[model samples]
Target: MMTGLHLVIARNNYVKKLMGLSIFQVSVIMLYVSMGKVHGGTAPVYVMGENGEPDLGVVYSSPVPHVLMLTAIVVGVATMALGLAIVVRIKETYGTIEDDEVIEKDRQEEEALADR
Candidate 1:
């Protein structure tokens, strides 16, 4: 019985570790996107030429990365929302939020069912 409980606890801890890793990965991706926005050039708009014609020396900032980041943000939010919902369901079904507790409860329930 003790061995069975230990196994359950170990499995739960592994799951929690995996979830934490996923959160870390998301944070890193967000950081990368944010760091890509900094620019040292002037705006891509024309002010005036030497003879008042038009100034074409101004550099336009790239909007491609920003647009991609917006898409990534939306996708990340949706993924996080879905993951949270699944976590909520797991908690409700197991009657505990801690990974080990949930696994232990599940093991006990399974044992009870098998004894019948």
Candidate 2:
């Protein structure tokens, strides 16, 4: 809900869009982590009994989701950094971070080119 709200609240600002994207990424990470949890479940470590038989009564929760979410966190950070860098470049080029303003500038440039 918050993710959708952030995305919709600031449509014209590039920096706000990046922040919304970062929030959405975090929400997804949280969802994955939450789904990985199991009630009354232990780690995926197997113990051997006296007869060298693996314990059959133990319920092991998979660590795959948690590990994948960790990787996702790193990737999300990198993506956010790259996005912010792009926004900075856009601000420099357009003299504003507003999406509408940038589009207007591009349209004016195209009109000038058409007249030439």
Query: Judged by lDDT, which candidate is best?
Result: 2
Query: Model 1 off-target regions past 4 Å?
Result: 1-26, 34-61
The alpha-carbon lDDT assigned to residue 23 of candidate 1 equals 59
Alpha-carbon RMSD, each predicted model: 9.0, 3.4
Find the candidate with the highest TM-score and give its number.
2
Candidate 2, poorest ten consecutive residues by summed lDDT:
53-62
User: Candidate 1: which pairs clash?
Assistant: none
The positional error of residue 52 in candidate 2, measured at the CA in angstroms, is 11
- Candidate 1, residues 3-88: lDDT per residue as tens digits? 33444345554345445545554565566666655344444454676898555565444466667767777886776677777777
For model 1, where is the 10-residue window of minimal lDDT?
1-10
| Candidate 2 lDDT | 0.81
What does candidate 2's lDDT look like per residue over 11-37, in tens digits? 789888877887787888888888886
